[model samples]
Target: MKDSNFLKENNARHMWHPMAHPADSLANPPKIVVGGDGVSIRDIDGKEVLDAVGGLWNVNLGFSCEPIKQAIAAQLDALPYYSTFRGTSNDQVIELSWMLREFFEPDGLTRAFFTSGGSDSVETALRLARQYHKVRGESGRTKYLSLKKGYHGTHFGGASVNGNANFRTQYEPLLPGCFHIPAPYTYRNPFNETDPEKLAQLCATALEDEIAFQGAGTIAAFIMEPVLGAGGVIPPHASFMPMVREICDRNGILLIADEVITAFGRTGDWSGSRHWGVKPDMMSTAKAITNGYFPFGAVMLNDKIADVFEQDTSGRGAIGHGYTYSGHPVGAAAAIACLKETQRLDVAANAGARGAELFAGLNGLAEKHDLIGDVRGGHGLMCALELVSDRAAKTPIDKATIGKIYEATYEAGVMVRVSGPNIIMSPPLILTVEDVQKIVDALDAGFSAA
Candidate 1:
């Protein structure tokens, strides 16, 4: 193992991290996480803190998941890697596909098209969506619609549909014909409505309006996150997704639920689409699919979408998009084990129970801390506290203040993600009630310092 000094130097000098300024590494060095146990991670300085970010919203089973680890090791020894492209298919991936089919069967997703990660999953889904339309003789349907604050992924296709300016601004001119509608955000919205149901109706109306303006025949699909994870853990009303589903059904537009962060019990359900009782035509999943042990993902397709390709005699029906590491054996093995443990433990139930406690605790913090402008979550393990300098004006908290809070919270024994003015938390599903209290208590310490 390299010493701390060497590690720190290389971290600043050689590596560039995602979603961070390259210069920031030298100015404010990134913490070097050396080891993890259960849900707590030990940094290079041997300081341990409960990880509230959950390895970028993927590590649902946490760092020390033995089953996934063993599966990876065993698969490596047997068959380290193999492609799922064309004729060649390995045993692990085959078994994994069968498991996935059964696992996501309730969501009306019967087919699995594997990918390397979230971005790839989304990219594949988008291409397939366009192709699906073309195969169905609707070659003109190439446009996409999504929530204004929703996040898909980093790929050009995903970024085009991505609603956040932070992810889109510098990358434009993105794919043409991609549009966004107002998200069902209760705290701050263009509509100024606070009621969840009402906001949902307005948001759905916005989607309808966009479709009408774009001409429904031109839109291929409406893609969205089930709970809106990266754009700040914004969980929509119960009726929101169902409304969108109905809208899509009526327009003959595919509803592609981007479940990268909300799948595998992150939203207190096996899959986020199932949470709202709406079945999407296609769904993109990753993150917890292998419990973050492997960089793997799958784009799930329903019978409606699959039938178009399966029964197509024309060459256009044949799928053209795929990743080289689509169904890597090692990743497949990890996913297989993860699916077993994920179901056996029924982590969704724990996520729901613990989430209620965390949400209540955060609300308590909101009452005490003037910095917290809004507290969002009641959905599951997904939660966020949007901070503000002044509650009345809802002015976003400064970076320095957020940094202070982050340092203080780490000192108080918790590791939370500070995304702009939002303190986002998507902790492990296995986290207990006691763990929930520690996170809240640590955040309280953070706020108290301010």
Candidate 2:
């Protein structure tokens, strides 16, 4: 193997990482992951750590998913690359579309529009939402609404609707007519409401108020992650999504479920919307679609939206948006293998079981460590630990303190994610009881060091 120092130096000098300052990479060199097996990753320094983050919450089947690997190789051998754009389509994409229709049947999504990844999927859904309105002669419906602290991707349209300032401050002058409502985040909310049910009702009311203020006739769609991911795994109350769905229906607005992190058995259900017994008008899915083996995603459309596009005779239904690799055969093959294995193993049950264990462990850690201000989880495998300097004041821990805890956690043999003052974990759904314990042990050690 090459010298670890040499590799680190080169990586620091040559690469700029996403969601990080380029200069900071040199000061705190990132761990160079060399290889992965099952739920563990080996860094260039030759230390193996339990990957509690699941490769950015996408590697649902873990690193050693052989069937998916084989499928990709086989697809490459047969047909390396092919586009599913206008005037052309591939057999792999056609087969995958049928499979997706059946898979997302409960969500009422009957058609799949392929994209390159989650961001592309969000862009497609947003554009299609507007076009759907145009097809029905409601061109005035051009506005969007979302929950504050919700993350949708980084595209112009997605970023415009995104509620987090961290992702939008620098890219100002984004698309207009995008607004936000308060999320049902019980930890820190403007309502000062601690009860989950009350919080859900308040947030839903806020959504209704926003629509009234903005005029429902001018709104195109309401997009949100059923369980907010990158904004810190904030899962809403059981009543939240269903209420939002009813509100959108009454307002003549479409609902887009951004299931990038909570789809395909991640939330102990096929889709997060199903977890709450709500079917969205459109669903943006990616991340685990191909088990993170390939860059692929799909924006699913329900029958109502499909009918509008299908029955349009005004030439407005012709899609003017698509990526060159929208439906690459290789990605489709990988997705097929992933879907089969996901259903065969029934990872959702395991996710629920292991998630309970993980959540309990995190709650235990919170009791032991005063730094842990809040522990959030219970929906499925996704969880987060928000750190604070003072429990009463809820003062956020500084970056230096978070860095110390992160390094200690890495040294203790578990790799989690640091998002602001939150330690997020989205371990592979295939995790065993032993794996869950190891992650807790690592975090315990990290808290001790901090």
Candidate 3:
């Protein structure tokens, strides 16, 4: 291997990372991951740590999934590239589509549209939602509503509907007709209600109010994450999604479930919509679809929406949107192998079991650490710890303090994500009980150092 310092210098000089300032890279060099095995990753400096972030909440099966790797290699050798744009389609995508139909049947989704990644999936769903309305003669329904703090993706459509200002302020004058409502976040909410069920009701009512204000006929869809992932793993109350579904049904607004992070057994269910027993009109899925092995995604359409396009005699249904690498054969093959392995291993059961332990461990840590203001996680492998300088006032911890905790956690042999004041954990579903314990121990040490 090349010298770690040399690699770091080159990376600092030449590479610009996502979600970071270019100048910050040179000041604080990012860890250069040399290799990964199972749920652990090794840096170029030879420090191995348990990966609690799970490759940005996608790698459910861990790093060394050989079946998917072999499938990609085989497909590359056979048919490396193909576009499913018009008449031409690859056999692998067709097979994967069939599998997706079977998998998403519980969520009432029957048709699949291929994309290159999560942003593509969200954008596809957003466009298709509007198109569905237009095909049904509801051309005025072009507006969108989403929850505050709910993250869809970075695309224009997704960003317009996204609730976070940090992502939107820099890119001004995004698409109009997009609005946001209060999220049912228990730790902090506009309603100031601590009860999850009551907050869900309040948020649902807010959604209803927003729909009424926007006019039912003018609204295209209500897009949201089942359990808010990037906005800090804020799982809504049990009654939340079902209430939204009822409201959307009454308003003639399509429900778009952004399951990019919560799909493929991340939330201890096949899909987050199914977890709440709420069937959305369209579902945006990616990330875990290929276990982070390939950049691929799919937007699933319910029968009602699919039938509209299928029966439309006009060319309006003809898709004008698609990526050059959409339905790439290698990605499709990797997804196929990933789906097979995901089911064979039954990672959902393990996620649920391990998630319980992790949640409990985090809560225990909260008891010991004054900096931990709130602990959130129970559904699956995803969890978060909100740090506070003053627990009584819920004042967010300073960046310098957060950096200290993060460095300590890294030194203690675990790699968790720090999103603002939140310490996020989404370890591979293949994690054992001992692995969970090790993560807890590492966090314990980190909190002690802080």
Clashes of each: 0, 0, 0
Please write out the lDDT profile of model 3 over residues 118-188, one tens digit for every residue. 99999999999899889888899999999999998999999999999988999989999999999999999
Candidate 3 pairs with clashing backbones:
none
What is the overall TM-score of model 2 with all chains considered together? 0.99
Report every candidate's CA lDDT.
0.93, 0.94, 0.93
Tell me the spans in candidate 2 whose CA falls farther than 4 Å from its real position: 1-5
- My TM-score estimates for the predictions, one after another, are 0.99, 0.99, 0.99
Model 1, residue 202: C-alpha shift (Å): 0.8
Number of the top-ranking candidate, with lDDT as the measure? 2
Clashing residue pairs in candidate 2, if any?
none
Write one digit per residue (lDDT tens) for candidate 2, span 46-148. 8999999999999999999999999999999999997777789888999999999999998899999999999999999999999999999999999999999
Worst 10 residues of 2 by lDDT: 1-10
Give the lDDT of residue 88 in candidate 3.
Answer: 98
Please give the lDDT score for candidate 1.
Answer: 0.93
- 1-450 per-residue lDDT for model 1 (tens digits): 998888987887787888989898779989999999999999999999999999999999999999999999999999998777898999998999999999999999999999999999999989999999999999999999988889999999999999889998998999998988999999999999999999999999999999999999999999999999988999999999999999999999999999999999988889999999999999999999998999999999999999999999989887777888999999999999999999999999999999999999999999999999999999889999999999999899999999999999999999999987899999999999899999999999999997
